[model samples]
Target: MYVVKSPLPDADLKTVADALQGALVDLVDLALVAKQVHWNVVGPRFRSVHLQLDEVVASARTHSDTVAERASALGVSPDGRAATVAASSGISSVPAGWVKDSDAVGALADALGTVITRMRQRIASTAEPDPVSQDIFIAVTADLEKHHWMFQAENA
Candidate 1:
């Protein structure tokens, strides 16, 4: 933990920061998966899916930054290195070979849905201890849900 003073106690800051760090890891993993799909998607919808995935990647990256920054504001060290993300993130690894458009969409939708579920849990956990942290989780969840819908729509 850093030396910055905050209204929240050290314990609460540590708790919230831990949750935020987990979320950050997942977001970073999600961005990498989205980009993997973007680069490998094939089939008739290839171009559209490829392009749309960039939006997901961008969202994940932005959310990761926000979460990491929040953790820092609370005097926690934000660990966003690739090794940390790989070790901490819950998202499944995307396959190495080229992926079909449908497969990529399905995989991404599932991953997004999983992250949204975890985000909601994080939001609930933060509510009483830190409503501001809850708000951050809420905002991230909403954005992820929107992207979830978009990605799932690709499979329909």
Candidate 2:
């Protein structure tokens, strides 16, 4: 039962909801992965990479909240549960042990790239159905891209 009704038509709402849910899962996973790496990263660049991972964690968390709220506004329940994220996230699983600083950088860059690619798809899918959601995806993609660039440069 949808206590909050959506203004969008049923078909459009479905499209937008799918995009929003996918985005939420990706963002949540991104935050978790970054935080895990932040805790385990080592090597000469450890200090810098650890700090950079925190930046990514912060951005992912902030964007995840925005995406979840947007979904709620549109009458879709956002599932940010760990199980849901693990099942639906587009990002690959993070390794389970201490990660070298360069490896951490590469891993984060790869994860960011994966999320950005999917965010672009969500942006397109929501464009006509819900421009507001599309705009959120666009903004999220831009921020993730910036982090991706920084991580890539860490190894350069």
Q: Which number leads on TM-score?
A: 2
37-88: candidate 1 lDDT, tens digit per residue:
8988898889988888999999999999999888878877789999998888
Pairs clashing in candidate 1? none
Stretches of candidate 1 above 4 Å error? none
Error of 2 at 119 (Å): 0.2
Residue 96 in model 1: lDDT: 92
Displacement of residue 2 (Cα, Å) in model 1 is: 7.2
Model 1: number of backbone collisions = 0
How do all models score by TM-score? Answer: 0.95, 0.98
Candidate 1: Cα lDDT at 111: 92
Q: Report the error of model 2 at residue 97, Å.
A: 1.1
What's the TM for model 1? 0.95
RMSD for all candidates, in order, please.
Answer: 1.5, 1.0
